[model samples]
Target: MPIKSIKKARKLIREKRKCVNASQWFCQISLAFFLAAILTNQLAYAFFDIAFLGELSTALQQAKVVWNVLMYFIPGLLMILAATALVMAGINGVVAFCYKQQLASLKRGEG
Candidate 1:
């Protein structure tokens, strides 16, 4: 993947977004959101635990209580994570389909 020469680097720069296509980028972003949402739930609890305490189990329980009360907007954070994941999956599927369509069009020289 490394540039073999300055010419190749210049060619890449000139290409800009001519590589992959926009729908592919959208699919990548949706996949990233899916991962981020999963991490966010775990990270919320871990953040509080890291900020406090000497005992692991006890510290995690305290963190959970604080997180639940503070993040009550979601009622249960797991529910939020699940909803976000579902949305992400739906988006990813749409974008992936669009990307495939774009590729097909490119092959047909419709652009």
Candidate 2:
């Protein structure tokens, strides 16, 4: 009801909004990186296929066998990395939100 309380409420709201916005931005950036990694990997595989196919030979067949083995494991490794990043981002966002809520409550002398 008082001016001081009004000012405190406004400040708390601003801080909470900033935290939420930051979390949203972080999520967007993480998703962009995930998509970029997937697309680039696909593009690399396509390029390798095109180049190797154009110059097919006995030696090339042996090389392809080794390359395919590497490629088979690369996707799994990329997926693990991506999953870790996603989990970290989600945890960060949740922590930020919790902190923001606590700040708001503290400003109101409720906690």
Candidate 3:
């Protein structure tokens, strides 16, 4: 093919959106994990003051059901977010791979 023809060829391959989105998903997951750790650590210290902690400790110890449910809920939400991000990254990766293949075929004049 002529240089002009190649330059004018409009392949459907995404330039950056798919790769960028895939990386963003991974970045979101990483940020979520980091924030979760920081918040959990800060909450632990804040909840451990000798005077103020006593009340919550007593309540939590007495009310096992609520404490257990709350304990599970936060982690459950984080896990859900992580799972969703991972699925999105997978989808973007698949799309980018297909796009790459199509572009490669076009390069060889096979498309």
Candidate 4:
């Protein structure tokens, strides 16, 4: 019985670690996407300042238009994705904390 209890505690500890790792990864992904979105937004504004409206070739002007749309649109999409990852990370963090508390109680033989 003691061996089985020890095994169960170890399993819980492993699960807790996995949850922590997953939460960390999700947070990192969220931060990266957020930074990328900010960068793209800044780039879009920088390109918007180009003063070659009347001097550029038709193809170049068309390319600029496409670039503007993509830059604007991509930031909004990425922000949404970042929010989702952040939410997932929060959930995982909560679960990991809960597991930690459970493990503590189990260790005290009061679980």
How would you encode candidate 4's per-residue C-alpha lDDT over 20-56 as one tens digit per residue? 9999999999999999999989877776776434677
Deviation in Å, model 3, residue 83 alpha carbon: 1.2
Q: Which 10-residue window in model 4 sums to the lowest lDDT?
A: 46-55
TM-score of 3: 0.60
Ordering by lDDT: 4, 2, 3, 1
Query: Residue 93 deviation, candidate 4, in Å?
Result: 0.4
Give one digit per residue, the lDDT tens place, for model 1 in 1-95.
23344445454434433333443554565565556656665676676667655655876777667776765443355455556655655665565
- Model 3 Cα lDDT, one tens digit per residue, 1-111: 767536534435345365767667776885686578557645644554432444456566666555456555665666666667777777777777776776677778885
The reply for model 3, stretches above 4 Å from the true place, is 1-16, 30-64
- Compute the lDDT of residue 98 as modeled in candidate 3: 72
Tell me, what's the RMSD of every candidate?
Answer: 11.0, 4.4, 4.4, 2.6
Candidate 2 minimal-lDDT segment of 10 residues: 72-81
Q: TM-score of the candidate numbered 2?
A: 0.56
lDDT preference between candidates 1 and 2, better one: 2
Candidates 1 and 4 compared: the better one by TM-score is 4
Judging by TM-score, tell me the better candidate of 1 and 3.
Answer: 3
Q: TM per model?
A: 0.34, 0.56, 0.60, 0.81
Query: Once model 1 is optimally superposed onto the true structure by TM-score, how far is the C-alpha of residue 110 displaced, in angstroms?
Result: 0.5
